[model samples]
Target chain A: MPDKTAPDAARRSQRSRQAICEAALSLVGETGYDKLTIEGIAARAGVGKQTIYRWWPSKGAVLLDAFTETMEAGEGTLPDTGDLATDLKAVLRATVDEFNDPAFQAPYRALYVAMVNDSEVSAGFTSKVMEPGTQAYVDRIRAAQDAGEVSEDIDPRLAAELILGPFAQRWLLRSQPLTHEFADSLVDMALTGLRPRNPRA
Target chain B: MPDKTAPDAARRSQRSRQAICEAALSLVGETGYDKLTIEGIAARAGVGKQTIYRWWPSKGAVLLDAFTETMEAGEGTLPDTGDLATDLKAVLRATVDEFNDPAFQAPYRALYVAMVNDSEVSAGFTSKVMEPGTQAYVDRIRAAQDAGEVSEDIDPRLAAELILGPFAQRWLLRSQPLTHEFADSLVDMALTGLRPRNPRA
Candidate 1:
């Protein structure tokens, strides 16, 4: 336990936690999740193994925390610029850019591999990453509904899925190249739809 | 290599291949992809390790072959019942049913986990599973276009992703409960779109 009277000690503890999380992220990227260990993280962070153990239960927990920290460091919500299509496209294009970046690929893939096999890890990811990210889109859709740009009949949750799911599918499967054009097409197809419009009822 | 003149030897080789694939699938279900090995599959299948080595270079290859065999045992095309929405819903519902089955959960998750981490495994999966499956939907969309049910201006490939991507995302992320209702909603959303229809030109 940290002493409440010692401000310097609390700051040192916070610094140690950040170092450990960063160490875990970089180590997983270098060695992959299968070989990452608490000892390696502690050694790299210049902290004791007991320090890691006191904070996180397992390596998966540490990685989850690391991923969460990265996400929180970004803007916490989806853009709501009044036009749903423009805002969603901008967000998705940025996501495509992130997915295409070599610097982020290894660590993200390692975390995803861990999430696939372990239910506990999967649940942690859902809570920390998926839920909040999805909620931001849902909020944007709701804002569109209020502005009369979107139909009231559309379920905001499902609308969020329609906007976000294609990107996740293409990225996870590596089935095709992820491009800005692809993001724009998803927004267009999702908004206007696949069926031709009839001007006359 | 089996003697071409010996029908009995050829039949025996076919049986051995089947046995090995089955063993690989069941072993992955029991112990997961991380713990699976060629030796374990050979032992479980009652074949020598040399037999497995002769046909496959690694455990990932063996699992890919196993998954391919499973997919081949089913009907090889998406349904084309003239109504694109109905047909897409039917296909997505069956996929959701397969995902929810306890019998299929372990082996499928193992294959997916392998796909995410290894580019070779992922490429095999794309060729063996993802591409063929997406092509089936694309063909049906084209059929719908010819029949005047869909817009010719719409990109068939992106339409397929819009149809299939939601199911893949929910299944992979476990973000929400995947239900038949969700499948139907996706079909509707992908068809009519999110914007309210304007009746007057």
Candidate 2:
């Protein structure tokens, strides 16, 4: 059994972490990443700046953690119910919904801007957020390959990239609205070749 | 015949425009887009801020012009060699070279960051820059379709999107280096589906 004091401390730590994350995200959103500072986050969260520094290395780190935490709260993981198409579509739909949410939009925009502008921030974001999210998809693709649902020769990493690339491009470029139907069409286009498969042609 | 005075005035105007574009690109490279200003660009280019304002609406516009001008200096059209593989590889290789150029990187990065953070800037970028570049690819794909190089039923827009998506994802995300070999592999993977043509049970 877990120690009783440990659970209480863990809960307290989690609360503090959540408060800090929320403060970081909101501050960055209100002011662009260029204007965001640890001092601003600490002041907003009602915590010492040192407390934030102790928990996070930089404002970018805090923003990444905040974004990840928010995504986790929204049924984050890729679903695996033994059907590749169903699983991919379900997770991608959730992602589209998240992308469309006003609350998620601001921080995501800030983080994306920071990622492109700052090399340190980009490294941190790729490792902390993008890598894990992409890994989940790769894992799903690999599972499908093992089950003979997908071509075994496909490079899982490249396949995951192909699967997610169109949506990411649209979202980041603001080329179009990210919608469930758009996600569905992207998945359909990717799974079946652009050439009509006589099956669906 | 054209009027001699009109030709001379056109030449002078073109020279001034080129100087302003150089100043904007160089200043943004050194100071970044957020710190870049019309005043600084004017001072650096030895022109009045009004001159810049007369030609462009914002710093974003100037940078976009600079980026487009740089891109156009090379093979400005998507290749339509009637062979999809040859055409795509040539274009992708050229793009890889451009993306890897140091002169092109900073201003592109600044514009990309600005696009993500500012909605109006993004829309302007999409219309003025992305749309034309993407259309070039679409035209090439359409040509390939017409020549029986690609499947006629393939959606040109989606096909172009898929081809460009991976490269954009890599460059913007900074997840990996953009290289000619990598571009070649992308073309190969994208054209030939990831699945083996023949699978052994």
Candidate 3:
């Protein structure tokens, strides 16, 4: 009886958390971030307002949690197949796919707007959201270095930025269409480089 | 006597234009963008409101013109030394310095915010400001390729993105301190790459 009842409670807790996150995400999209509130999320999620206050201190926290949840739910984690090129291409594809989806894009954008508008958000945005997400790439790059699949001279930290920088610019700044072809091209260029042409060749 | 009169007229026109750009840049910084007005700029510049109207279509246009003028005043243009490495480093250094300055930084940020907020601004922002800026790097990279300083297989357009993307990310997103050391490291990594280690080496 204890085993069955305990598992059921755990499942209920998970479902409530999911509903809260989803509610927070959609409300932010429809009404905008500044207008979002704990009461609204509670009403939409069908939970008590106390439930939200127990979980998150502010709307920003809930939204970021949801953002990370959305990324993970759709794409498990960035690939780590020991091959740097294959892993990077997989991650880039997943990222492009996420950005392309309207459901995900809305909350993602709201989170970014807050990050840019508020100094408090900006300071933590990199460490809390950006840095943790980049860790997957950095870890994979480090492993590749050990296997001699990547140059040891390249800083994993900066290398990850090099890999993502073009995509980020196109996605956010240029608002250019991101395709797999573009992703492949970025990986190829950064990995092999436009090595200075051989004078003789 | 005609030559003297014509020279005086041209000088007055040039002085008025200078005053207007300077006034526009400073006003946007202190008052913020949406609150900025043409009449305010005219008053600050000590010129008639019609003078501004004759030269620029909207406040947005005036802001952009002033933004570009500041860049030319300091750096002249993105460098194009015979060597790609030398040219790229020079351009990166200049860009970092411009973003680091408070006067240049303020309107520069407003332009970006507008690009994100308004579709019309977005379309022109990429073409007018971003494309022209990126073009300098592209042209230099193409020249380097012709001179055997850069590999032919590497697309000049993509290569230019690799060079500028890091700086853009750091400037816009990270809002981190911009430094020559960081710029030099970016150039070095993109140029040589963290290529897969030599199995024997």
Candidate 4:
């Protein structure tokens, strides 16, 4: 039989890890990335700074882990209801809502900015967050193509970018408001090209 | 006659301003933004630290001015060769080249990261760089619509985003290569809707 002490210790370590992730997210959201510290995260989580340092190399790694855990816990495949435009719009609209959430804005932007300058941070974010996220959309687009909705000539990965790119750009630049209406427009334009549909054809 | 001394002073000040902007760009390119300092820029430009501080509030502002001047000096309306696809592809391919250029990468990423946390930097960049750049595309799209190549029902601004957004996303996330081939695919997919063209329509 497995040792009872081993199981108990594993549980405690897991609990500590979760608490540290929560604290890192909370502190970055409240004070932003520049002011965040390992000590502050430790104090908030009631763990020693040594514990944090032992588990993670830096505050950026802690935050990346926090975001990755939070995302994975709630991650679901993109919805597919046979109707391509309807499904894509649902996903984009939900994303817009997430981007606008007060709890998500500061911490998300903090990680985003960090990744811009830090190669390690960028690599971690790309592997842990971006790849999985892009894969979901790619799967959805492939399904649509199989259903005879999207053209076979299109690359599903690039098609996914066409659908998702506008929202990312607008959000990053704050060029304009991200509304459900904007999401709908993107889905429509992406599905139906800029060429005027030939009514008589 | 106008005071010759006043004109001479104005010429000297203009020369100093150009030197400072050039120095700021070159230093940021070589050392990256984190190591850049006003004193460094002044020393490189052969000007006093007081001159840099007197003109700009922060390094971010100085960088913004430098970028804006560089872009404006070369700013031209997007080409409208009547073939929308060819024109857009040319513009995007050139952008791909610019993004991949060694000299453009570090300082551009620096300003991009700075704008994430600094609202003042964001506003300055939006007004000075983004707005003018976007407008060029908007004008080209408008011209295309008038020429009957694109659908009149399309919003020039939104359509512009559809074409530009994918490039921005791929570049920022570093998810894939931003090649001329990728630029061509974006134009093709964007021009022809994802739906397979009805051959007998």
| Local distance difference test values of all predictions, in order | 0.86, 0.80, 0.77, 0.86
Residue by residue across A1-201, what tens digits does model 1's lDDT show?
867768988999999999999999899888876678899999999999999999888787888888788874455588777899999999999999999986687778878887887778889998888888898888888898898877779999998899788888898888889999999999989888888886332
Residue pairs with backbone overlap in model 2: none
Off by over 4 Å in 1: A1-16, A35-57, A199-201, B1-16, B47-54, B199-201
Clashing pairs in model 3?
none
Task: Tell the DockQ for candidate 2.
Answer: 0.46
Error of 4 at A99 (Å): 0.7
Candidate 4 per-residue lDDT over residues A1-201, each given as its tens digit: 767998898999999999999999999988876668999999999999999998998887898888888775445488889998998899889999999997988888878877775768889998888877888888988898898888888899888899888888798888799999999999999889988877444
lDDT of 2 by residue, A32-89 (tens): 7767898999899888899888888777778877887775543435777988778888
What are the models' TM-scores? Answer: 0.89, 0.82, 0.74, 0.89
User: Per-residue lDDT tens digits of candidate 2, residues B76-173?
Assistant: 36866567887889888988998888778889899998788777778888987888888888888787777665666578887788778888888888
Clashing pairs in 1: none
True contacts kept of 3: 0.50
Candidate 4: the clashing residue pairs are A201-B201
Give the range where candidate 3 chain B is weakest over 10 consecutive residues by summed lDDT. B72-81
Which sections of candidate 4 miss by over 4 Å? A1-16, A37-51, A72-74, A199-201, B1-20, B34-51, B72-74, B199-201
lDDT of 3 by residue, B96-163 (tens): 88788887777876676555544466677787688878877787788878888778789988888887
Location of the lowest summed lDDT over 10 successive residues in candidate 4 chain B: B67-76
- The better-scoring model by DockQ among 2 and 4 is 4
Identify the candidate with maximal DockQ.
Answer: 1
